[model samples]
Target: MNVMIFLLLSIICIGLIFIIHKYFGKEELYFLAIIYAIVALMMSFKTIKIFGIDINASIIFDSGIIFILYYFIRKYKYNESKKLMLSILICMLITSMFLITTSIMIPSLYDEFNFSYQNMVLDNLPTIIIYPLSLLITMSLSSYCFRQLKEEEDYRLIKTILTIIGITFIEVLIFIYFSYAFMIGFKKALIISLNSYLAKVILMIIFTIFLNIIFKVKKVKE
Candidate 1:
């Protein structure tokens, strides 16, 4: 059930990427990337079991952000993807600030959900900080790699799959180490990170295939 939901969300996100690219413009893709980055940060606090292994629920959106970055790099310019990355970072920082401020605020007497919201944000403060930093590093790396390989038309799919695997692995390692290791113990954190990477790699591969198909179809239409 969780796996099904994960795939459904992945498909919807990938579909939206092409839809925005086709109808809207690069500006809309930037908007979508920022929205996904914010949602991914919020979802990092939640964990779900897939195939009986624990993983962050944010993987779907995170992969979407990467796909959008790759799309920018491939179709637009490398610098444009960097602009999108910086935009995402700025938006995420603003979001983190908002979460921090809201968490510290005293709630009104009638605010029933304030405690839960405050606790969730306070408890995951480390994650709020670390996740974006990890994202910045890994996304920089992913974009650099995609830029290097973008000119290779024959091996595009293979190179993209490999790049996603490498980027996702590093991202999981950095985020889980900084955010989860001390709190959950190194051993448990290692296990969860490995599980999370596996899930992310699978989802990324699926996104890569769909994205390639979209590009091909668009090329044919052009």
Candidate 2:
């Protein structure tokens, strides 16, 4: 969460990505690490108030990361590989540490309200439960889309970017339904859900496009 600590972790994560790429010949993990680190950095700088809950912006990056992991596991046929599974687990654990640390330590705009991870109580337990469940559900749903897109050769880059956005939007919806609506009643949650969905759709679209451009430039250099 601290800038110095985040920087140190970023260097270590990037180094690990290079090692994985070099040893296993999977460069996709490098890109994944880059996206994760970049998003983590961006998220450290801001928080948003949504549905009376203060959430970190890095939550927006969850589905994209999940999509990348799902894409690679399917692409490499690594579902049965223990080593690959271990590596993926390691990546997720590291990312979770970052997310947990940042989310717990950073004071949200509504710091006076005790409703998040740091102040976990009976009132917020359902939200905490739904958060990780929604992540798994989002990734599972995203797997179908990624599987379909991974096979197509035509406009694959564009397809991949769009898929990421679509899945992220789906995550927003799920988060709203399972988490937000339960926290607040359904009637009030509807409008907030719509606004959140649209906001995430636009943000992920722009983020995906920027990442696509970076990939293009990297490919050209290679």
What TM-score would every model get versus the actual structure? Answer: 0.94, 0.55
Query: lDDT of each model, Cα atoms only?
Result: 0.87, 0.53
Candidate 2, residues 1-222, lDDT tens digits: the string is 344543354345334433443444456564564466345434523445654544444554553455345536544664523343344445545555565565556476776763544543334444445554565566566656767866788997678767776776776667655565676688665765666666566555654554444333322212
Question: What tens-digit string does per-residue lDDT give for candidate 1 at 38-61?
Answer: 989998998788889999889889
Task: List candidate 1 segments past 4 Å from native.
Answer: 219-222
Best by TM-score: 1
Clashes in model 2: which pairs?
A: none
Which run of 10 residues does model 1 get worst, by summed lDDT? 213-222
Winning model by lDDT: 1
Report each candidate's C-alpha RMSD, comma-separated, in the order given.
Answer: 1.9, 8.5
